[model samples]
Target: MGTKIPISVLVVIHTPDLRVLLLERADHPGFWQSVTGSVDGADEPLAETCRREVLEETGIDSAAHVLTDWQLQNRYEIYPHWRHRYPEGVTHNVEHVFGLMVPDAVPVTLAPREHLAFAWLPWQEAAGRCFSWSNAEAIRSLPARAAAW
Candidate 1:
Protein backbone atom coordinates (compact mmCIF):
# COMPACT_ATOMS: atom_id res chain seq x y z
CA MET A 1 0.00 0.00 0.00
CA GLY A 2 1.12 3.52 -0.66
CA THR A 3 2.09 5.68 2.29
CA LYS A 4 -0.22 8.49 3.38
CA ILE A 5 1.06 12.00 2.77
CA PRO A 6 1.53 13.75 6.08
CA ILE A 7 1.03 17.16 4.52
CA SER A 8 -2.39 18.79 4.19
CA VAL A 9 -4.12 22.15 3.87
CA LEU A 10 -6.67 24.08 5.95
CA VAL A 11 -8.42 26.83 4.02
CA VAL A 12 -10.47 29.48 5.74
CA ILE A 13 -13.19 30.72 3.41
CA HIS A 14 -14.38 34.22 4.21
CA THR A 15 -15.51 37.54 2.84
CA PRO A 16 -14.15 41.07 2.93
CA ASP A 17 -16.70 41.92 5.60
CA LEU A 18 -15.01 39.69 8.16
CA ARG A 19 -17.58 36.97 7.86
CA VAL A 20 -15.92 33.56 8.07
CA LEU A 21 -17.31 30.33 6.71
CA LEU A 22 -17.26 27.09 8.65
CA LEU A 23 -18.25 23.53 7.84
CA GLU A 24 -19.42 20.95 10.34
CA ARG A 25 -17.71 17.61 10.05
CA ALA A 26 -19.95 14.73 9.03
CA ASP A 27 -18.20 12.23 11.28
CA HIS A 28 -18.00 14.58 14.26
CA PRO A 29 -21.30 16.42 14.21
CA GLY A 30 -20.59 19.62 16.08
CA PHE A 31 -16.95 19.86 15.21
CA TRP A 32 -16.65 22.74 12.71
CA GLN A 33 -13.67 23.87 10.66
CA SER A 34 -12.64 25.53 7.44
CA VAL A 35 -12.09 23.69 4.19
CA THR A 36 -9.60 20.90 4.74
CA GLY A 37 -8.23 17.92 2.84
CA SER A 38 -5.07 15.91 2.53
CA VAL A 39 -2.69 15.85 -0.40
CA ASP A 40 -3.70 12.85 -2.51
CA GLY A 41 -0.19 12.18 -3.81
CA ALA A 42 3.43 13.14 -3.33
CA ASP A 43 3.64 15.23 -6.47
CA GLU A 44 1.01 17.86 -5.59
CA PRO A 45 2.52 21.10 -4.35
CA LEU A 46 1.09 22.57 -1.16
CA ALA A 47 -0.37 25.62 -2.93
CA GLU A 48 -2.11 23.51 -5.54
CA THR A 49 -3.36 21.26 -2.78
CA CYS A 50 -4.85 24.29 -1.03
CA ARG A 51 -6.69 25.49 -4.12
CA ARG A 52 -7.90 22.03 -5.04
CA GLU A 53 -9.18 21.27 -1.54
CA VAL A 54 -11.21 24.46 -1.19
CA LEU A 55 -13.05 23.69 -4.40
CA GLU A 56 -13.66 20.06 -3.52
CA GLU A 57 -14.93 20.72 -0.03
CA THR A 58 -16.88 23.93 -0.55
CA GLY A 59 -17.74 23.93 -4.25
CA ILE A 60 -16.20 27.37 -4.56
CA ASP A 61 -13.87 28.08 -7.42
CA SER A 62 -10.48 29.18 -6.08
CA ALA A 63 -9.79 31.20 -9.22
CA ALA A 64 -12.94 33.22 -8.61
CA HIS A 65 -11.91 33.89 -5.03
CA VAL A 66 -8.92 35.35 -3.27
CA LEU A 67 -6.91 32.30 -2.30
CA THR A 68 -3.98 33.30 -0.11
CA ASP A 69 -1.16 31.18 1.14
CA TRP A 70 -0.58 32.20 4.73
CA GLN A 71 2.86 30.63 4.73
CA LEU A 72 2.06 28.86 7.96
CA GLN A 73 2.07 25.18 8.86
CA ASN A 74 1.16 23.20 11.94
CA ARG A 75 2.43 19.78 12.92
CA TYR A 76 0.21 17.82 15.28
CA GLU A 77 -0.41 14.22 16.18
CA ILE A 78 -3.30 12.56 14.46
CA TYR A 79 -6.14 11.85 16.83
CA PRO A 80 -5.97 8.17 17.71
CA HIS A 81 -9.44 7.38 16.39
CA TRP A 82 -8.71 8.91 13.00
CA ARG A 83 -5.31 7.32 12.53
CA HIS A 84 -6.74 4.41 10.57
CA ARG A 85 -6.78 6.64 7.52
CA TYR A 86 -3.03 6.74 7.60
CA PRO A 87 -0.47 4.05 7.32
CA GLU A 88 0.89 2.11 10.29
CA GLY A 89 3.02 4.14 12.67
CA VAL A 90 1.95 7.42 11.07
CA THR A 91 1.25 9.60 14.06
CA HIS A 92 1.04 13.16 12.87
CA ASN A 93 0.34 15.56 9.98
CA VAL A 94 1.67 18.87 8.76
CA GLU A 95 -1.15 21.26 7.80
CA HIS A 96 -0.59 24.32 5.65
CA VAL A 97 -2.87 27.35 6.04
CA PHE A 98 -4.71 29.23 3.31
CA GLY A 99 -7.46 31.85 3.05
CA LEU A 100 -10.07 31.99 0.28
CA MET A 101 -11.74 35.35 0.02
CA VAL A 102 -15.14 35.43 -1.54
CA PRO A 103 -16.74 38.83 -2.15
CA ASP A 104 -19.26 38.33 0.60
CA ALA A 105 -20.76 35.78 2.93
CA VAL A 106 -23.17 33.61 1.00
CA PRO A 107 -24.74 30.21 1.00
CA VAL A 108 -22.26 27.43 0.16
CA THR A 109 -22.68 23.89 -1.10
CA LEU A 110 -20.70 21.41 0.92
CA ALA A 111 -19.59 17.94 -0.06
CA PRO A 112 -22.06 15.82 1.89
CA ARG A 113 -19.59 13.06 2.66
CA GLU A 114 -17.15 15.51 4.18
CA HIS A 115 -19.43 18.06 5.85
CA LEU A 116 -23.03 18.26 6.95
CA ALA A 117 -23.66 21.95 7.55
CA PHE A 118 -22.31 25.42 6.91
CA ALA A 119 -22.41 28.73 8.75
CA TRP A 120 -21.15 32.25 8.30
CA LEU A 121 -20.26 34.27 11.33
CA PRO A 122 -18.33 37.37 12.13
CA TRP A 123 -14.63 36.78 12.55
CA GLN A 124 -14.59 37.22 16.33
CA GLU A 125 -17.38 34.72 16.91
CA ALA A 126 -16.09 32.43 14.24
CA ALA A 127 -12.67 32.36 15.86
CA GLY A 128 -14.23 31.65 19.22
CA ARG A 129 -16.25 28.68 18.00
CA CYS A 130 -13.96 26.77 15.67
CA PHE A 131 -13.32 23.22 16.87
CA SER A 132 -9.69 23.32 15.91
CA TRP A 133 -7.06 25.60 17.37
CA SER A 134 -5.37 26.14 14.05
CA ASN A 135 -8.68 27.15 12.49
CA ALA A 136 -9.36 29.64 15.27
CA GLU A 137 -5.87 31.08 14.95
CA ALA A 138 -6.40 31.58 11.24
CA ILE A 139 -9.68 33.43 11.82
CA ARG A 140 -8.07 35.60 14.46
CA SER A 141 -5.35 36.62 12.02
CA LEU A 142 -7.83 37.70 9.35
CA PRO A 143 -8.41 41.31 10.28
CA ALA A 144 -4.79 42.35 10.28
CA ARG A 145 -4.05 40.43 7.13
CA ALA A 146 -7.06 41.82 5.30
CA ALA A 147 -6.20 45.33 6.43
CA ALA A 148 -2.63 45.11 5.23
CA TRP A 149 -3.72 44.37 1.72
Candidate 2:
Protein backbone atom coordinates (compact mmCIF):
# COMPACT_ATOMS: atom_id res chain seq x y z
CA MET A 1 0.00 0.00 0.00
CA GLY A 2 1.11 3.55 -0.67
CA THR A 3 1.95 5.75 2.28
CA LYS A 4 -0.96 8.07 3.01
CA ILE A 5 -0.50 11.74 2.35
CA PRO A 6 -0.78 13.98 5.39
CA ILE A 7 -3.25 16.19 3.56
CA SER A 8 -6.90 15.11 3.90
CA VAL A 9 -10.48 16.18 3.66
CA LEU A 10 -13.24 16.04 6.24
CA VAL A 11 -16.73 16.15 4.78
CA VAL A 12 -19.58 16.87 7.16
CA ILE A 13 -22.68 15.35 5.63
CA HIS A 14 -25.87 16.88 6.92
CA THR A 15 -29.42 17.84 6.14
CA PRO A 16 -30.94 21.28 5.72
CA ASP A 17 -32.41 20.87 9.19
CA LEU A 18 -28.98 20.37 10.83
CA ARG A 19 -29.03 16.62 11.22
CA VAL A 20 -25.47 15.37 10.81
CA LEU A 21 -24.46 11.97 9.54
CA LEU A 22 -21.76 10.14 11.48
CA LEU A 23 -20.10 6.77 10.88
CA GLU A 24 -18.82 4.26 13.40
CA ARG A 25 -15.31 3.16 12.58
CA ALA A 26 -15.15 -0.58 12.00
CA ASP A 27 -11.71 -0.78 13.57
CA HIS A 28 -12.65 1.33 16.54
CA PRO A 29 -16.25 0.46 17.28
CA GLY A 30 -17.35 3.38 19.42
CA PHE A 31 -15.27 5.97 17.64
CA TRP A 32 -17.55 7.90 15.29
CA GLN A 33 -16.71 10.55 12.74
CA SER A 34 -17.68 12.31 9.53
CA VAL A 35 -16.47 11.15 6.15
CA THR A 36 -12.67 11.57 6.09
CA GLY A 37 -9.88 10.45 3.78
CA SER A 38 -6.57 11.54 2.38
CA VAL A 39 -6.16 12.63 -1.20
CA ASP A 40 -5.65 9.75 -3.63
CA GLY A 41 -2.39 11.36 -4.82
CA ALA A 42 -0.46 14.55 -4.48
CA ASP A 43 -2.20 15.98 -7.54
CA GLU A 44 -5.78 15.10 -6.49
CA PRO A 45 -8.03 18.01 -5.69
CA LEU A 46 -9.34 18.40 -2.15
CA ALA A 47 -12.89 18.74 -3.47
CA GLU A 48 -12.57 15.48 -5.36
CA THR A 49 -11.17 13.80 -2.28
CA CYS A 50 -14.21 14.98 -0.33
CA ARG A 51 -16.59 13.64 -2.93
CA ARG A 52 -14.79 10.30 -3.13
CA GLU A 53 -14.70 9.79 0.63
CA VAL A 54 -18.36 10.76 1.07
CA LEU A 55 -19.47 8.23 -1.51
CA GLU A 56 -16.99 5.58 -0.41
CA GLU A 57 -17.90 5.73 3.24
CA THR A 58 -21.65 6.43 3.11
CA GLY A 59 -22.58 5.37 -0.40
CA ILE A 60 -24.02 8.84 -0.91
CA ASP A 61 -23.22 10.39 -4.25
CA SER A 62 -22.02 13.89 -3.41
CA ALA A 63 -22.68 15.04 -6.97
CA ALA A 64 -26.40 14.64 -6.39
CA HIS A 65 -26.50 17.00 -3.45
CA VAL A 66 -25.30 20.49 -2.52
CA LEU A 67 -21.65 20.07 -1.56
CA THR A 68 -20.14 23.24 -0.15
CA ASP A 69 -16.52 23.92 0.67
CA TRP A 70 -16.64 25.64 4.03
CA GLN A 71 -13.09 26.94 3.57
CA LEU A 72 -12.13 25.67 7.00
CA GLN A 73 -9.01 23.66 7.78
CA ASN A 74 -7.48 22.00 10.82
CA ARG A 75 -4.09 20.55 11.61
CA TYR A 76 -3.78 17.96 14.34
CA GLU A 77 -1.37 15.32 15.51
CA ILE A 78 -2.02 11.93 14.04
CA TYR A 79 -3.09 9.39 16.60
CA PRO A 80 -0.14 7.12 17.44
CA HIS A 81 -2.04 4.04 16.37
CA TRP A 82 -2.67 5.39 12.88
CA ARG A 83 0.78 6.78 12.27
CA HIS A 84 1.78 3.64 10.44
CA ARG A 85 -0.51 4.59 7.59
CA TYR A 86 1.50 7.67 6.84
CA PRO A 87 5.10 8.18 5.87
CA GLU A 88 7.81 7.59 8.40
CA GLY A 89 8.21 10.54 10.78
CA VAL A 90 4.95 12.12 9.76
CA THR A 91 3.16 13.31 12.88
CA HIS A 92 0.30 15.49 11.77
CA ASN A 93 -2.36 15.85 9.12
CA VAL A 94 -3.91 18.96 7.59
CA GLU A 95 -7.63 18.50 6.96
CA HIS A 96 -9.79 20.60 4.68
CA VAL A 97 -13.42 20.86 5.75
CA PHE A 98 -16.47 20.65 3.51
CA GLY A 99 -20.19 20.20 3.99
CA LEU A 100 -22.69 18.18 2.02
CA MET A 101 -26.29 19.20 2.40
CA VAL A 102 -29.04 16.75 1.73
CA PRO A 103 -32.69 17.72 1.79
CA ASP A 104 -33.30 15.60 4.89
CA ALA A 105 -31.93 12.71 6.91
CA VAL A 106 -31.38 10.24 4.13
CA PRO A 107 -30.66 6.55 4.45
CA VAL A 108 -27.03 5.57 3.91
CA THR A 109 -25.26 2.44 2.75
CA LEU A 110 -22.15 2.03 4.86
CA ALA A 111 -19.02 0.35 3.53
CA PRO A 112 -18.71 -2.69 5.77
CA ARG A 113 -14.93 -2.76 5.86
CA GLU A 114 -14.56 0.84 6.89
CA HIS A 115 -17.68 1.55 8.90
CA LEU A 116 -19.94 -0.62 11.03
CA ALA A 117 -22.93 1.68 11.54
CA PHE A 118 -24.33 5.09 10.67
CA ALA A 119 -26.63 7.57 12.33
CA TRP A 120 -28.19 10.92 11.58
CA LEU A 121 -28.47 13.03 14.68
CA PRO A 122 -29.16 16.63 15.61
CA TRP A 123 -26.05 18.76 15.19
CA GLN A 124 -25.57 19.27 18.91
CA GLU A 125 -25.99 15.62 19.76
CA ALA A 126 -23.81 14.62 16.87
CA ALA A 127 -21.06 16.96 17.98
CA GLY A 128 -21.17 15.46 21.44
CA ARG A 129 -20.78 11.97 20.06
CA CYS A 130 -17.77 12.63 17.87
CA PHE A 131 -14.41 11.37 19.13
CA SER A 132 -12.37 13.89 17.20
CA TRP A 133 -12.37 17.47 18.35
CA SER A 134 -12.11 18.69 14.80
CA ASN A 135 -15.13 16.66 13.78
CA ALA A 136 -17.12 17.96 16.70
CA GLU A 137 -16.16 21.53 15.97
CA ALA A 138 -17.29 21.16 12.38
CA ILE A 139 -20.67 19.86 13.50
CA ARG A 140 -20.95 22.63 16.02
CA SER A 141 -20.43 25.11 13.22
CA LEU A 142 -23.33 23.66 11.26
CA PRO A 143 -25.88 26.06 12.70
CA ALA A 144 -23.95 29.08 11.48
CA ARG A 145 -22.88 27.45 8.25
CA ALA A 146 -26.37 26.28 7.44
CA ALA A 147 -27.71 29.69 8.25
CA ALA A 148 -25.51 31.26 5.62
CA TRP A 149 -26.39 28.77 2.90
Candidate 3:
Protein backbone atom coordinates (compact mmCIF):
# COMPACT_ATOMS: atom_id res chain seq x y z
CA MET A 1 0.00 0.00 0.00
CA GLY A 2 1.16 3.48 -0.73
CA THR A 3 1.90 5.71 2.25
CA LYS A 4 0.13 9.02 2.59
CA ILE A 5 2.05 12.26 2.75
CA PRO A 6 2.12 14.44 5.86
CA ILE A 7 0.71 17.35 3.86
CA SER A 8 -2.99 17.60 3.16
CA VAL A 9 -5.67 20.00 1.94
CA LEU A 10 -8.86 20.99 3.73
CA VAL A 11 -11.43 22.39 1.32
CA VAL A 12 -14.48 23.92 2.91
CA ILE A 13 -17.29 23.55 0.38
CA HIS A 14 -20.01 26.10 0.88
CA THR A 15 -22.80 27.96 -0.86
CA PRO A 16 -23.01 31.65 -1.55
CA ASP A 17 -25.18 32.25 1.49
CA LEU A 18 -22.60 30.73 3.86
CA ARG A 19 -24.05 27.23 4.17
CA VAL A 20 -21.24 24.76 4.59
CA LEU A 21 -21.13 21.22 3.27
CA LEU A 22 -19.80 18.64 5.70
CA LEU A 23 -19.19 14.92 5.29
CA GLU A 24 -19.49 12.14 7.88
CA ARG A 25 -16.47 9.92 7.92
CA ALA A 26 -17.03 6.23 7.31
CA ASP A 27 -13.98 5.29 9.31
CA HIS A 28 -15.22 7.22 12.31
CA PRO A 29 -18.96 7.40 12.08
CA GLY A 30 -20.55 10.60 13.40
CA PHE A 31 -17.33 12.49 12.89
CA TRP A 32 -18.04 15.10 10.24
CA GLN A 33 -15.58 17.28 8.39
CA SER A 34 -14.96 19.20 5.18
CA VAL A 35 -13.50 17.68 2.07
CA THR A 36 -9.98 16.64 3.09
CA GLY A 37 -7.28 14.43 1.67
CA SER A 38 -3.54 14.00 1.66
CA VAL A 39 -1.35 14.91 -1.28
CA ASP A 40 -1.17 12.02 -3.70
CA GLY A 41 2.52 12.61 -4.38
CA ALA A 42 5.32 14.93 -3.41
CA ASP A 43 4.96 16.90 -6.65
CA GLU A 44 1.17 17.35 -6.64
CA PRO A 45 0.12 20.98 -6.51
CA LEU A 46 -2.01 21.92 -3.48
CA ALA A 47 -4.76 23.37 -5.67
CA GLU A 48 -5.01 20.14 -7.62
CA THR A 49 -5.13 18.21 -4.35
CA CYS A 50 -8.03 20.34 -3.19
CA ARG A 51 -9.90 19.89 -6.44
CA ARG A 52 -9.26 16.17 -6.53
CA GLU A 53 -10.40 15.67 -2.93
CA VAL A 54 -13.57 17.70 -3.43
CA LEU A 55 -14.41 15.70 -6.51
CA GLU A 56 -13.48 12.35 -5.07
CA GLU A 57 -15.39 12.81 -1.82
CA THR A 58 -18.35 14.91 -2.93
CA GLY A 59 -18.60 14.30 -6.65
CA ILE A 60 -18.42 18.06 -7.04
CA ASP A 61 -16.26 19.30 -9.85
CA SER A 62 -14.74 22.18 -7.92
CA ALA A 63 -13.46 23.71 -11.13
CA ALA A 64 -17.04 24.52 -12.11
CA HIS A 65 -17.44 26.47 -8.88
CA VAL A 66 -15.43 29.27 -7.30
CA LEU A 67 -12.51 27.50 -5.60
CA THR A 68 -10.20 29.77 -3.67
CA ASP A 69 -7.02 29.15 -1.76
CA TRP A 70 -7.35 30.91 1.57
CA GLN A 71 -3.56 30.99 2.05
CA LEU A 72 -3.99 29.49 5.50
CA GLN A 73 -2.12 26.54 6.94
CA ASN A 74 -2.52 24.57 10.15
CA ARG A 75 -0.20 22.07 11.72
CA TYR A 76 -1.93 19.50 13.89
CA GLU A 77 -1.12 16.17 15.44
CA ILE A 78 -2.34 13.16 13.53
CA TYR A 79 -5.05 11.20 15.22
CA PRO A 80 -3.69 7.96 16.62
CA HIS A 81 -6.14 5.78 14.73
CA TRP A 82 -5.23 7.35 11.39
CA ARG A 83 -1.52 7.59 11.91
CA HIS A 84 -0.98 4.18 10.36
CA ARG A 85 -1.74 5.62 6.94
CA TYR A 86 1.53 7.50 7.03
CA PRO A 87 5.11 6.41 7.56
CA GLU A 88 6.46 5.61 10.98
CA GLY A 89 7.16 8.58 13.25
CA VAL A 90 4.77 10.77 11.19
CA THR A 91 2.82 12.25 14.06
CA HIS A 92 1.81 15.58 12.60
CA ASN A 93 0.34 16.98 9.38
CA VAL A 94 0.37 20.35 7.70
CA GLU A 95 -3.02 21.17 6.23
CA HIS A 96 -3.63 23.93 3.69
CA VAL A 97 -6.99 25.66 3.71
CA PHE A 98 -9.23 26.23 0.69
CA GLY A 99 -12.82 27.21 -0.01
CA LEU A 100 -15.19 26.24 -2.78
CA MET A 101 -18.24 28.38 -3.31
CA VAL A 102 -21.17 26.83 -5.08
CA PRO A 103 -24.16 28.80 -6.32
CA ASP A 104 -26.43 26.80 -4.02
CA ALA A 105 -26.51 23.80 -1.73
CA VAL A 106 -26.17 21.01 -4.24
CA PRO A 107 -26.49 17.29 -3.65
CA VAL A 108 -23.29 15.36 -3.14
CA THR A 109 -22.33 11.77 -3.96
CA LEU A 110 -20.27 10.56 -1.05
CA ALA A 111 -17.51 8.01 -1.44
CA PRO A 112 -18.60 4.89 0.43
CA ARG A 113 -15.16 4.16 1.77
CA GLU A 114 -14.40 7.69 2.85
CA HIS A 115 -17.73 9.17 3.87
CA LEU A 116 -21.08 7.74 4.95
CA ALA A 117 -23.31 10.81 4.83
CA PHE A 118 -23.29 14.53 4.03
CA ALA A 119 -25.11 17.66 5.10
CA TRP A 120 -25.46 21.33 4.22
CA LEU A 121 -25.70 23.33 7.39
CA PRO A 122 -25.60 26.98 8.28
CA TRP A 123 -22.04 28.07 8.87
CA GLN A 124 -22.35 28.31 12.65
CA GLU A 125 -23.88 24.89 13.07
CA ALA A 126 -21.48 23.49 10.54
CA ALA A 127 -18.57 24.75 12.54
CA GLY A 128 -19.93 23.06 15.62
CA ARG A 129 -20.48 19.81 13.81
CA CYS A 130 -17.00 19.52 12.38
CA PHE A 131 -14.76 16.95 14.12
CA SER A 132 -11.55 18.82 13.43
CA TRP A 133 -10.63 22.13 15.02
CA SER A 134 -9.01 23.42 11.84
CA ASN A 135 -12.09 22.56 9.82
CA ALA A 136 -14.32 24.29 12.35
CA GLU A 137 -12.12 27.35 12.44
CA ALA A 138 -12.17 27.58 8.68
CA ILE A 139 -15.94 27.34 8.58
CA ARG A 140 -16.30 29.97 11.27
CA SER A 141 -14.16 32.33 9.22
CA LEU A 142 -16.35 31.97 6.13
CA PRO A 143 -18.59 34.96 6.76
CA ALA A 144 -15.72 37.40 7.11
CA ARG A 145 -13.79 35.76 4.35
CA ALA A 146 -16.73 35.80 1.99
CA ALA A 147 -17.35 39.41 2.75
CA ALA A 148 -13.83 40.21 1.70
CA TRP A 149 -14.13 38.22 -1.50
Across 33-119, the per-residue lDDT of candidate 1 in tens digits comes to 888889989999877888888778887878877788899999998888878888888999999998888998766779999999999
Q: Order candidates by lDDT, high to low.
A: 3, 2, 1
Task: List lDDT for all candidates, in order.
Answer: 0.87, 0.92, 0.93
**What local lDDT does model 2 show for residue 103?**
90
Q: What TM-score, over all chains together, does every model reach?
A: 0.94, 0.97, 0.96
TM-score attained by model 1 = 0.94
Q: Which ten residues in a row have the lowest lDDT in candidate 3?
A: 1-10
lDDT of 1: 0.87
TM-score of predicted structure 3: 0.96
Model 2 lDDT per residue over 1-149, tens place: 23999999999999888999999999999999999999999999998998899988988988999988899999999988889998899999999999999998877999999999999999999999999999999999999876776
Extract clashing residue pairs from model 3.
Answer: none
Where does candidate 1 stray beyond 4 Å?
none
On the 0 to 100 scale, the lDDT of residue 66 in model 2 is 90
